[model samples]
Target: MYTISTKLKVILVLVGALCFSVTVALAQGPGFDEDVEDVPVPFDGGVTFITALAAGYGIKKIREHKEKTK
Candidate 1:
């Protein structure tokens, strides 16, 4: 048997709500009844920026963890 902490229960509920909202919104789709033409999505620099930021954060956290273990 296992017991979940109050904090973890709250976090799980919030995540579940977020996922349900996203699913419902996606199912609703864009409101229009016309023939839509295929539009190409542009490659934005934001993707690269976010990737670099995440990589940097990950590296920093790994270094901190290694130091703490030492």
Candidate 2:
């Protein structure tokens, strides 16, 4: 189990809330046309690799933080 300090938890919650709100806004008020064509190909190998790297880094950071608290 991980124990997060009150301040750290509050900060994390605020940041997550901000991110969630921003994502919701972007999704709701889309500037891009849904019927638009000629869009670039979706998610080549490089994009997949980058996404995997980001997820791995986030998991590693969380694990390290938990270890430190222990």
The sequence of per-residue lDDT tens digits that candidate 1 reaches over residues 1-70 is 1356877888999999999999998998678667877789977999989999999999999999999999
Separate clash counts for every candidate? 0, 0
Q: Give the alpha carbon lDDT tens digit for every residue of 23-45 in model 2.
A: 88888754677777876877679
**Which residue runs does candidate 1 get wrong by more than 4 Å?**
1-34
Highest TM-score: which candidate? 1
Off by over 4 Å in 2: 1-42
Prediction 2 global C-alpha lDDT: 0.88
**Residue-pair clashes, model 2:** 0
lDDT of each: 0.90, 0.88
